[model samples]
Target: MEMEKTTDPTSFHGAYRMTPATFDELLALVGPHIVKQTTNFRDPVGVSERLGITLRYLATDMSQRDVARHFCVGRATVCKIIQEVCQAIWEVGAPLFMAKPTTEDWKKIAEEFNNQWNFPHCLGAVDGKHIHIQKPALSGSLYFNYKRTFSTILMGVADAAYRFIYLDVGSYGREHDGSVFAQSTFGKALEDGTLLLPQSPNGDLPYVFVGDEAFPLKPQLMRPYPGKNLSDKKKIFNYRLSRARRVVENAFGIMVSKWRILRQPIIAKPEKVDKIVKAIGVLHNFMREKEGLEVECDVGSESGMTDVQIRLGANMYSGAAWDIRENFANHFSSPQGSLPYQNDIVQRGLNI
Candidate 1:
């Protein structure tokens, strides 16, 4: 009698096609050392297969069970693989992406802020974005935000080039932007003066950051003038500040777009949520460095604003008009020899 043939249960349906170049590129960003290898006796799937499968899931928004089925592994195995990948990315790639700006880097950023958005002595643009995560099995309300949804806060500081200089994640979803900032390490840095403020090139001005109305009005933080029928100059200043402040929004968009895992409601435990966010951030920076992708800036199209508006907008936003007008009587008057107002002007120029 002829023997019947049995199909291999572990055989993958789709052709396994990944080039060394692709693997090398991924490894360069994520680091080869952190990537786990399969061994004998404890025979497991190939490292490439595991990483590729997990990344495919992240990139495609596939369910973990679906990924497991595609890879011919158990659902638990898929989760393990994802955990490993995330941990690897954090450990090996986090440093490569998140770098504190050096003095020269700060100068370059400041100059760009001055030239582009008319904010000066501004080191970085700061913002908070809500990243939706799966409700934790144990503490669901802890992650609920004002939006009445579960999400973790992603606060970031980006330079003129739109690269993240600092990132903090895993704040409770219910917390407001101010609350998150007040409790964060970066906030502490600011409060304690550990995070150095940019020095004015002229030695008489202080540094400042541009923030939305959501942030408090302070010497270091600026908000747009809240009124209609304002003078052309104040309007121009608002426009310029808005333009510079857009960098943080763009950064958030790029991040969520690249890591589709973040796009999905994260289902991981609350304690591990920080790891997931850090991993995504590390990957973002890694891709930037290893892939040499140009950092995109969204300075509104030239067609949108007239040449006069652009020039005036740039100047007004930079506080040049404020610098010139010291009559303190006219609508455009600024306090004479006032360091705070001067710093505000420089800050407006830098577009923080």
Candidate 2:
């Protein structure tokens, strides 16, 4: 028995098979009925098998040749299969994931921020993160960012419930958050007031968005004051702001974790990166909805309160009157004072 360790060719092939969940999700998106069947000598392979092979490759990080060899097809066939599957996933799931938040939705989000994070009169948190991508064949320098790394910008706005309202991709890796945002459609909407903020009982409660210190401070944009003399009020404000802002980080975590494809270096050309980014976002939304984890926000019909009433309520709390800046200064100067820990840092550090 010790001398006879035989390997079966079929056993090696079985290990490359796609999981049932992956196969079913793909078939559900692109029906098995419509998938082309192999027949003629010119036909490379069966659509179902090609799709399965593509899933296996993406899910396992296997090379194209590995997938091709497993499916007994050429590497070109594997490439085509990946493109087709990616396109299919995008077409079937895009609408399900990237929905525009309604007025009522915004209202609900505002409530969550106020209740959960103590950040009042906020509709959503906005920020940008980098997703590494293979360098473009034609314009390598365009996508490079200040970090000196090659990555595509993933700019998104998320509600307190962690639901993404808007997302943008395709920016060159070289752009900074502010620079990339300035050129984005969402940014333009914000500047033009087309993307209206929710009206609170306190005269639109002066809707504010939270971001990191890298972004400039403005009436609409709130960042922590960097100084000594950190007072209790400022510390509380920063703590609450950090809490609500973490939804975006959680969203990104779920995305990369579920789709390990994002964990590895994206080897596709820059031109195809947009599709890849969109496909992942769409998939993220779809999965969230399917799992019934989608957070519902009430943007309007505060059925609960009228806009004027909400504005009046917000006016009652003069956040500025709390001397937030003084509090911030005190906290930074204290030996024991510290910034809130971001989930991305805590979790990612552990993983590394």
| TM-score leader | 1
RMSD each, Å: 10.3, 11.8
C-alpha TM-scores of all predictions: 0.73, 0.69
lDDT tens digits by residue: candidate 1, 1-352: 1111124322221121123444456655554544445566565655666666656666556788888887778899878877787778777766666766666776787778767655656667777777776777777588776656677777877766667778898777776666676688987787787765556654333465665555544445555665666654555456556766777666666666555666667677765667767776776666556544433312322111111001112112335323322111122233432223434554455442
Stretches of candidate 1 off by over 4 Å are: 1-23, 28-32, 35-40, 203-205, 292-352
Tell me the deviation in Å of residue 181 in model 2.
Answer: 1.4
| C-alpha lDDT score of every prediction, in listed order | 0.59, 0.59
| TM-score between model 2 and native | 0.69
